[model samples]
Target: MTARHRFDPTILREYDIRGVVGITLCEADAHAIGRSFATVVLREGGRRIVVGCDGRLSSPMLEKALVAGLTASGADVVRIGLGPTPMLYYAEASATDIDAGIQITGSHNPRDHNGFKFVLHGHPFFGAAIQNLGVMAAAGDWEEGAGTCEDRPVLAAYVNRLLEGLAGVDPARLAALRIGWDAGNGAAGPALERLTARLPGEHHLLFTDVDGHFPNHHPDPTIEANLADLKALVAREKLDFGVAFDGDADRIGAVDAGGRVIWGDQLIAIFAEDILRRQPGATIVADVKASRTLFDAIARQGGHPVMGSSGHSLVKAKMKEIDAGLGGEMSGHVFFADDYYGFDDGLYAAVRLMAATVRLDRTLAQLRDAMPETFSTPELRFPVDRARKFAAVGEVHARLAKAGAQVVDIDGVRVTTPDGWWLLRASNTQDMLTARAESDTREGLERLIGEIDAQLALSGLSRA
Candidate 1:
């Protein structure tokens, strides 16, 4: 008998498979994903698959079902147990025996949400690849055999690899720093605990206990509200700086000694300075949503700056294409191929940030203070009809093109005006239209935002 499964249409996102657990996604879906993915792997002449899960309560059940599907398809499964998404990436990237990897994580989403992220043959498996899984599952197009599953813990090795980001830093300067970390009770907790134990400095950790309910706060560090705890921790401890991680610990958020939230692009600028110093004229990539200031900073340092489409997987693909030494996003997904593998790892970013501070001989706050001042709106996401979101952006793009506005449409429409810039793009993961604007003056920022509003209004929508 052939086995066929149908996924909830909404779960097949552009970057990964995600949905609200028990509602739109379930154990059966996990099984189908495993079976389908394993079939693809077998077709590619690969048999070994690595899997890991986050701290979510539903992860264990999904992992069990997923493994069953994989093994049924004759794919050998190596389960890395519980850890951050990067740990799964690390296992796959470092192991010669591994052919592909998947991480069961909800990322920075709400507690009830859960999903899977994948890497195959050292490349991101997403977009069309993700959609094909659904097609294969619905057709029951899977190989059959009884393969085996085994557990191999990689947390220790993963932590050690993260420490390598600081390999050349002076131990004395590192020890002189005082830092704070907020894991937000995500999968990074255990790894953070282990890394901090070996790191030099006075470290204060918040929400390191893995709690699926996220009793204290949500794990999304990009949101200002979510960083309240981290900010308070830094202020109370008088630490040099603080770093935070999202649910699966792939995205990062930070605060300096004065407790100001350092946005993602600003962090890239800091990293770019150090990296360009070592590898001059190297290409540095940043997503379209990043500030113009960051692009100029990279260029000023004699580094080539490339604007990438937003989304971690897309940025990673672009980085690989351009052979970029560093890449990042406004959402805090930083990738480093200079001293480490080109993947977004929050823990590794933290270590590199520390090393940068030590080598530059400047406080984190000082590095932040040196960035050009620009007033910008945070990512403004508003719900739109799933079918209409992309259309709306297209309409805006066409209108802007007709108007002869300076536009960069690498991902969406980023209008570069005399003020600064404004971006309008559809969210790849959700049925929402995301917008952002920046400028040197408050008045200019308002005008840029007004332009965004006008464009959205023309598309029969409004930020309100």
Candidate 2:
């Protein structure tokens, strides 16, 4: 008889399957996810599912086990091998035979962490769907069938698609621009090495090997500390710009020639204007935390600007609902629907950034300089018990409203004041409370920060 493995309930999440290395998850659990997910896919009449993984050491092992489970469920699996989360999404959207896709990635989480990003029938398979999958697995309801796995290298094809759009972009001046890249030794390195060969620019690289350890810096570029090496590279080489990627390369960050970090909203503004000029009156979406400047700019360019919740799956769902041309978050996830599938792709975003810079005949900093300035806080994270985080946000929201503050509660409570706006929300992926404040000036920004501090103090949380 086959051995029966106990299912750990926590590995199944609202958005995708995720957990630690051994305690909460393992190869057996991954096998269960694969099999169970495959059964779910097949039951939905899915014929093909695309699978891929990030550079986490456990990913390949888990992926192999997952494919086994899928095959056992009598489904055909197309392994996209190693690539970014977007590439997996791209394959699913582009392939007529594919009905679903699963990315075995931990995203920008710590080194030992891993997870899955699932798509079902061209829509995000998340929330209650993910939770229900867990119950089915524990019940051992996964179907048994003659499932087989086929290796499909979609990276080359994916790159070709991105390059075709950027093919006409000339690099005569970019050849003089020095560039620096930090893959964080994540999955994007191998692909980026090839992309750089096509560009005419002086380049420097760090952590190009796909090491799951992530020794030099964390793969998350949203955090300021992670960009230290990239900043140093820019200053040392006097490079025009420096770019960094998350573990899966679906998100990105950049430093200007002056070594200043450019937030996601600013990047979106740069891209939104360019996209609108080509396809006027297109719609752009951004998370609530993005600056008001971005929303205003999109409108100025004859585009509609919409704000929504802050999760990868949530944003993508909103993108399709509104048929948006572009969408992004402060955390660096950017989705494009103008020329490609409505999935976030950091590599693709970079290509467009390069083309925009080239086509406008403006340097990275020069284009950035043309945008209006506003004061904003970097995202601030404070530890809160998982159970209490949401409640705290609720309490804070209620109090802010009773106090007669102008409040918006899409993701959390974002209070709009005469001076500026402040946002307080519970992080979807971690046991933390996230906050950001922005205004027209330094004093206004500080007032917004102080408001957040007062609310946290009341909740028995601290900035420290």
Candidate 3:
């Protein structure tokens, strides 16, 4: 009989398993996750599972333990070694025989934090499925057998597929475009380095070395501070545009020629315009946090616009339901189901962005300039008690309903006014309430902010 272990309940999250290393997550927890996940896979008639890890310092040890647990449960393990989370997703999607994939990545979290992202038969394995794994582990109900393990090299092939996005792009225009890429010393560094080496034109890359410590800067690109280096490189090198990837390279961030940062919604707008040109009336989805301009832009391009809940898993699931061509989040997670797998891949998004620019025959800066100017507050997140968070959102929802506001409450409350729109949603992954408001003018924007603040006060909470 094998010894069964229990994990800290908090580590099992809504979308994936994540917790601080050593304190909340450890090698033992990794082993239990493997055991439980493998049992579920085998019961579903799966025998082979693909596993990958990021460049984190603790990943290799956890990977070894996880494989041990998987094989112990009689599931064959195919280890792809260290790479970005999306690379593991690519491996699973491209491989016909693989039943599932597990990528051990921290994913833009602090260095001390680590987690697991799963895909079972190309669909996200999360929410209730994640909770069930915990239940199975605590009961020590994993299957018993000795399974096989092997290593495979798929990086070169994956990189080649990414380059295929430029297939129809004008060669001369692509060759004329100079781009800068920053990997932020995360798991995607090596892959990004290889990608830029093969891409057309002069490609300047920064922090392409895999460093778990993230000595240069934090791996998250959603924050403006993290893009300073990439922006400077673009300016100094006079590059046409720049791209940045998060820790596991699932999220993308970019800067135009003038060093102006293009938020995730803006990038999706650009993608929607180009994609709609080819695939007329395709559906484009963006999370509720996205700007109104993005939705309007997609509609103007003859594409259906969908406002999805925030989170990669939610966005991906919604995309599948609607058969959308493209979907993305304000957090930089972009998914493309048009000509590729419906998974967020920062490196792939960057390549596609470049292809879009070349195919559209416009400079990135010029395309950005053409968009309507809307004053908006950056996404504002404030800490709230986990137990009280949902209750607070409920209170706000009731208030808005009593007031008869035009609100979309699929995931949260997105209220619309004559000026523009404002969103207040409780984050799925954290004990935080996030709010964003946008308007055509400063006065309208201020009014929207005031409304958000008033709602928060009604819920006995105030922005910090």
Candidate 4:
């Protein structure tokens, strides 16, 4: 007999499940996921699933339907209300009673998109687990029992935890701090509003309201143009610092008081150094796309630095594997296990940055200046047919042997040379090819970029 209700497996991804709402993922799919997840959790002996959602117009409805499925499958539900992805992660990691959680979000995806992030037993639940959920949902094999669903202000408690972790930053030091927060019209907008109220300073806000339409700009700060408002506000207001968040506020980007971008690598580098101070000889992991400056800084601070593949799920998995005190991606997902539960939270990261700034008693510009200097290219994106990007990378990999380049293929290919390193990789979340090059000198960086360009051209792709 055919399966009772089969959820599509194509949408099940390596990290989280995402697709264009109504097209690939609808209320029916959400309900199936809830039932599937409930079955899995029950089989694994879990009784509850912490549920949350972002500001996307589709999120609330999805959460409701998913909860219905969860209750049908004999799993209790704890609703944390609407907030950033990290708040969902925080609430899951904060309490020992909750065994699994799911955040209904689209993250940095376009407005037409929505998805779910799942965590089971304090680890990111993905890959095969997601596929299995689909199978169970389709089979209609989920169990049935009486289940409880509760509503509570988990956001306030989450904010309090962040404040406690950043208690070192005295209110006096913050008085002179004029800050700008670009919420990017995502789940973090509301949370940022509440968190900023506690700090002692004049805080400028942008897109702090929850608008799934994202009226101001796309919610992703990783794209440089999306950061325009924050940069301009900093420049015009002479602000002490500026912070921006991706759709869910799990990833963070910063601008110095001078309006210069403090990229993910640099921001995490600062946090890594502070973490090492607290626990010497600690292990800290950063994705391969991260800058060498971060690795060197971590080593200098007597910490073990690990380079791993890129992807939020991959990094989070590695963090648990190594018992790493911290881990981050160049895309701005920074996980802190030092004093917190070791998940990326833009608000928490911002607080720690504030503390770091105050502890050093230096302006944000001065702190950024304390790091080593190097010439680097911004992450450049070029469209590649989804089917061809991987093949192109494989083609380039095959050619690497004849070229005699130090090709490191952890994420894609990172050709290291005496003067610099250049990377060419396919975006895990999109049908695009991305490249970045860094060097101690500008000439070296140029040469590296030329090599990547030539390689892409040779692979039958054109640079954007």
Candidate 5:
């Protein structure tokens, strides 16, 4: 008889199963996830699964335990050992017979934390599917049989595929451009080093060694402070632009020749311009936190602009539903359903960015300068009790509705004004409320901020 298992309920999240290792998550939880997930796959008539792990210290142990449960549950496992989360997504997307994929990754979290991201039949496995896995684990209802496991190293193939994004890019122009890349010693390091080696350009790389400790810096690039090293490198080398990736290489960050950080919305704007040029009137999606300038820019470029909910899974679903050519978020997850798979891959985004620059006949700095000026607050995250975050958004939404304010409540409450817009939403991944405001002028921006503060006060909270 097989042993029964129960996972810590808190480890199951909106988009993935995550927790601090040894505290809320362990090898046992990993095994339970594999068994339960395999059972679910089998119920759906799926028989093969792909498993991948990051370079974290805890990943190997988790992967071992997970494979045991998966094989025991009668699912053939293709173990793509030691790669980024996107690599797992690629493996599943590219496989002819694979039914599911799971990646053991800590993402951009601190060293002590880890988690799993999943894809089922080429779609994100999240929300209710995550909760169902917990229920199945608790019931000890899993398939049992002897299943096979195979080892496959796919880094070189993945890197080669990324280069395909540069098909129409001018090679002479690519060679003329100097670029810098920083992987922050995360799982994306080795892949980045391999990618740049074959690309056309004067290339320089930083911290290409896989170090889960992240001794150089935290792997998250969205936070401006974490990008200090990359910015310094770009400046020192006078590169045309610099690119960086989050821990698992799913999120991207960039800086131009002047070492100015390019926000995610701005990156999408660049991508939209290039993509819309070829596929006119294509639907392009950006999350609510994206700058209004991005939406306006997409429209000006003859593309349909869509404001999507603020989560990668939600955005991906929306993209498929609308057959969107491109979709992205302010947090740096760019998805391309145009010429590539509709999954968020930072390395792929970087490749497309290079192609965009070369094809447009403009350097990154020139592209940045071409955008209209807008004053926007950096994403503000304030602590709120987990239980009250959603309720608070609901409360704010009611008041806005009552006042007949011009608002968009797709994800949260985004009030639009003659000056600009302000948004308040509960973060899906953390116990916090996120807010942002943007305007054409400083005074208008202040008004938008004040509106956000006023809305928060109504919920008996203060921005921190």
Candidate 6:
């Protein structure tokens, strides 16, 4: 029998397979992904694969179908059951027998959305690899045979491993600190609950129940609005700091005791300072969208700062290539290869954040306060025709080049001016154009935004 399938074009993205569940994605797509991915694994002379799912309402259904497909394609499936995306990454990275892994999750997307993130042989499986799944499925190119599936709950082990991140911190310092955590009612809730119970200090938790409805707020931590509950909790408790997780617990958001949100780049700066102190002169990679302040901070700390593209997968690959001890995206995906596995784990990051603060002998708020101040707009995203997004960025890049403007063309056009820097990039995951500007002063920041606006206007588009 011949088996063939085709995914909605939108679902086969650069980094993962994702879409609105009933609309662009469905059980059939999940099955196809599993079958096709298994073929890829089998062809690579591997058969063991790990699978997991998030707290999304549809995740169980998708996971079942995916497992059936994997087994049908002759791939042994080790089901890790429900958990955050990083737990799946952990299973794949730590297990000596597993050849690849997949996590059914929506990540930071809305409740109605769902997706799959893949790791093959401990490395991110994305970009061309993701697209190739579609190609193979459409062509009915899949292996065949009856394989086996088994359940292995690793949530406790994963939580214990996260505790290791705080291994070297002084117990007295940790016991004295007060912290708040918000799981955003996502897949990370259970893990967060278990983790805090074992940690020292006064711990306050919010929305740690795995509610797929997300009754409190959206799960995305990158949006300031999503962190309102966490901010409020931090302010009310007068805690040392607060940390929040996205839908799948791969990205992290933080707020100081003053209830001030710490943007991803700023978090990177703090982490870099701590990492550099231990690994002196180690390489730290930050996505290009990060503030120049972060880059400068790393360099000032005697670390090598390398700017890479924005996606987590891309950043991870870049980090591996350059042997970077730490890497992060401005969107809150932080990776630490210094003392732990080189993967983005929000729960792990929270632990490390505390360790960093204690080891530095500073309060989280104090560390945040010491950072150089700068004004910047949050990442602005507006829709553009999928085909037009890249072209528009290219047009802006050419114009900036002809004008003799200093630009970093790594992932897009980030034009540097005496006042500040403005970035215009086409988002790889969506049909959207993203822009950001930063400067040392409010006036300079406004001017940088104007430059972005002008470039967009020239491209026959305007910021909304």
TM per candidate comes to 0.99, 0.94, 0.98, 0.93, 0.98, 0.99
| RMSD of every prediction | 0.7, 2.1, 1.0, 2.1, 1.1, 0.9
Residues 43-74, model 3: lDDT tens digits = 99999999999999989988999999999999
Collision pairs in model 3: none
Tens-digit lDDT track of model 6 for 1-464: 79899999999999999999999999999999989999999999999999999999999999999999999999999999889999999999888999999999999887999999999988899999999999999999999989999999899999999999998789998999899999989999889989999998889999988999999999888888988888888888788999999999999999999988888998988889888888899999999899999998899889999999999999999999999999999899999999888999999999999999998888888998898888999899999998899999999989888989999999999888999898999999999999999999999999989888888898889978
Candidates in order have lDDT scores of: 0.95, 0.86, 0.93, 0.87, 0.92, 0.92
lDDT by residue (1-464, candidate 1, tens digit) is: 89899999999999999999999999999999999999999999999999999999999999999999999999999999999999999999999999999999999999999999999999999999999999999999999999999999899999999988889789999999999999999999999999999999889999999989999999998998999999999999899999999999999999999999999999999999999988999999999999999999999999999999999999999999989999999999999999788999999999999999998889999998888888999999999998999999999999889999999999989999999999999999998999999999999999999999888888889988
On TM-score, the stronger of 3 and 4 is 3
TM-score for candidate 1, residues paired by index: 0.99
Question: Model 4: what TM-score?
Answer: 0.93
| Model 4 misplaced regions, further than 4 Å | 1-3, 6-10, 138-141, 401-404
> Cα deviation of 12 in candidate 4 (Å)?
2.1
Off by over 4 Å in 6: none
> What TM-score quantifies how close candidate 2 is to the native fold?
0.94
lDDT of 6: 0.92
List the candidates ranked by TM-score, beginning with the highest. 1, 6, 3, 5, 2, 4
* Cα lDDT, model 4, residue 430: 72
Candidate 4 residue-wise lDDT, 354-411, digit = tens: 8877776777798799999999998889899978988999888889967787888888
Candidate number with greatest lDDT: 1
For candidate 5, the 10 contiguous residues with the lowest summed lDDT are: 1-10
Off by over 4 Å in 2: 1-9, 171-177
Q: Write the per-residue lDDT of candidate 5 for residues 371-431, one digit (tens) a residue.
A: 9899999999999998999999999999989999999999988889998999999988889
The lDDT ranking, best first, is 1, 3, 6, 5, 4, 2
